[model samples]
Target: MKAALMYGPNDIRVELTKKPDCPEDGLILKIMAVGLCGSDIRNLTSDSRKGNYPFIYGHEIVGCVDEIGPKQTKYKVGQRLFLFPGTYCMECDNCISGHSENCENEHVAKLAGTGGFAQYIAVGGEKIHYGGIYEIPDHVSYEAASLGEPMTSVFACLENAKIGYPDTLVIIGAGPIGDFMASIAKTRGAKRIIMVDLNAHRLEMAKQFGVDEIIVSKLDNPQFAIDEVLRLTGGKGADKVISATPANATQAQSLHMVKKGGLVVFFGGVPKGSMTELDTNLIHYNNIWIKGHFGASYDQSKRAFALACSDDFPADKFITHILPLDEINHGIELTKTGEAIKVVLHPWDESFYP
Candidate 1:
């Protein structure tokens, strides 16, 4: 098997590697498509997490079951499936409370060593039992199914915020995740959806995804975005605001972009040890709620996968590029330029490989 091994920042090499064996309680998947996520890009560069050196980095995965563990009765070989990027212990306090995303003992894809940037990955042991894998419907393309992981977090955030009719929703980024937030908000009956971003091109692209308004903000003019959001909401501000970009400025501006008593969801994470100063008086005087969200629970993942399979969710439109596995560096560069929305890598597309 050949895999893109990440040695350090801006260093990923595609080379022949030992194929992962099927686990006694799990299975081996031959990766079909894996989405290049923003987090993956971050990890590739400055935001590297503490993990084993030279590990694979992709997580948004859709693959076919190549080999089934003898003890794994839930699925068989030759089945197409989408695997969630994170795993948790079902016996933890958070897991028992239905918040498995925050389980005390949890591991993401890179930490689990089952990254999908390769020909095959071994998934087994307790991960299969906790239900991180789902079958892809025959109608959903492998490229679209690869977005299930990110979509799962979108579902979890919207469910937590409870955005609905007559409520104006404001999203603080125009990237793919922010676009997903806007689209899902429409189905939840949000009266209006406003998107803000620094990239004019991405904002233009977001117009097609049910965005009611777009605000172009500059780093030096954060208040301009808040004022624009207020103007769009008839000076009352939005009922729900989501900071979907990994920038502290957007997260700070989101506080002032919401109406009194409204909720603000911090859906994107900043670098470790980074801090942002927020107005606590806004929370105390205005009765506002600020929630920080991360990954998705198993139930949320299932619902997101089902939504992706449905006709209403435009999964195909979100995919802007598809490249062979060996072109991972080029894919990462495309993502950084804000030129691509979702870049799906086809590991088995040997025709395109050089």
Candidate 2:
């Protein structure tokens, strides 16, 4: 099997590795397509996974069941599938309370050096029974199905905010995740959608994706975006604000961008051990609600897959580049330069590269 192993920060090499064996109670997937996520870039640039170096790390996976375990009865060989990525213990306190998304003993199926970056990954043990795999629909393209995992988080965030008709939704970040937030919010009947970002080129590209307005934020003058959001909302502020960038400035600006009694979702996470100073008076005097979102629930993952399968979701448009597995470094660079929206890597397609 050929896998891209992360040796350290900003270092990745593609080399031959032993193929993972199928778990007695699990299965092995021949990875077809895997989408590069923002988290992957973050991990690549930092030592967050220092001790776990030289391991595979992709999670937005779409593959075919190459080999099935004898104990696995639900799926058959050669069936195409999408990964939910994370699994949880049913006996955990969070799982018992029906909030398995917060399970204390959660296990990521992509871990243990058998992630989607490889040509073949073995998913076995408790992960199969706890829910991390779903059969892909025949009509959905592999590239689109690879986006299901990221879309699940978007669905979870919107569901938490209860965004609906006549709500002015503002998303801070013009990347793929922010675009997903805008797309889902539109389907939920948001009256107006505004996107803010530091990249002017990214914001220009976002216009075709159903964003009602785009604000080019200034890193030096952070208040410029706040004023622009207020001006666009007729001085009332947006009804809901989602800080989709992993920047402390944007996260703090979300509070001032939303109207009184509105909801603010911190969709992007800041660096570990870093804290932002926010005005508590805004929450106390204006009756604001601030929420922090992380992973998605099983139900949200299912809904995200169904939505990706639908014709209305524009899943294909989200994919801007497709590359071979060996070119993983180039793919990562494209994402960092904002030259690509979503890059899907085909682990087995060594002959084709774009």
Candidate 3:
């Protein structure tokens, strides 16, 4: 087996390793594709020395069950699957309270081990199911399955905000995650969807998925964009404003763009100790709800995987790069630029090694 391991800042190398064997209650996957996530980049360059070196970083994954342990024979030798990389301790107070992702025993995940970057992984326990291992539908592309985590995170945000049909929606950051939120917003019947982002290319990428009404973030009159949003909503502002960008400005922008009694969501992760001040009046006067959604619930994995495998979202459109294991460094570099929407590592790509 071959995999890429992160040693330090801006460094990765391909190495040979023994294939992982399935645990008694687990399965083994032959990784097919994995998407580069913002967190991965953060881990690469985080100021903290907490990151585990010689680590595998990918988490957004799509692959197939190559084999299964005796107890997991229900999953066969050739099932296409998407993994829920989160593993929660079921005995924890939070898990006992049915808040698995919030399990008190589980410390925050700063780095992902056994990453999707490798050619194979031994999948197990709570890490494998809410319902069960998802069998990808024939119609779903590998790229869509790779989006399981990103879409699931967006779904968690929607749940937190309670966004519904006939609501006006404004999304900050037209990045891949933001665009995924827009896709879901439209699917949920949002009355009007306005997307805001700094990248024209990302806005253009959103169009590839058939979204319109994007506001470019680079303008002196950022308020003009908000004004257009207000105008689109008959001057009441949006019912829901989501900041899928990690920037503090994006979150602040969401506050200003939403109407009184509207929901403001931060669906993207801000680093540790990062802080921002908001006008307290908005909370008191407008009755606005400021909500932050972190990772997805372990209990939602089965449903998320099904949705990840569903035909509804054209998730394949999200993948912009697919490289072999040895070229994984290139994949990471591509994702570093705002331009590469999604980059997947294919350990099996023959060109990577030769």
TM, every model: 0.94, 0.96, 0.86
Q: List the residue pairs that clash in candidate 2.
A: none
- Please write out the lDDT profile of model 2 over residues 31-84, one tens digit for every residue: 999999999889877886856778788989888999988888878889998878
The digit string of per-residue lDDT tens for model 3 on 233-295 reads 788888888887777767766777888988888777777888866778877899998877776
lDDT scores in order: 0.86, 0.86, 0.72
Model 1 scores what on Cα lDDT?
A: 0.86
The local distance difference test score of model 2 is: 0.86
Quote the positional error of residue 291 for candidate 2 in Å.
0.5
Q: What TM-score does candidate 1 reach?
A: 0.94
- How many clashes does each candidate structure show, in the order listed? 0, 0, 0
Return the top candidate by TM-score.
2
Native RMSD of candidate 1 (Å): 2.2
Considering lDDT, where higher is better, how would the candidates rank from best to worst?
A: 2, 1, 3
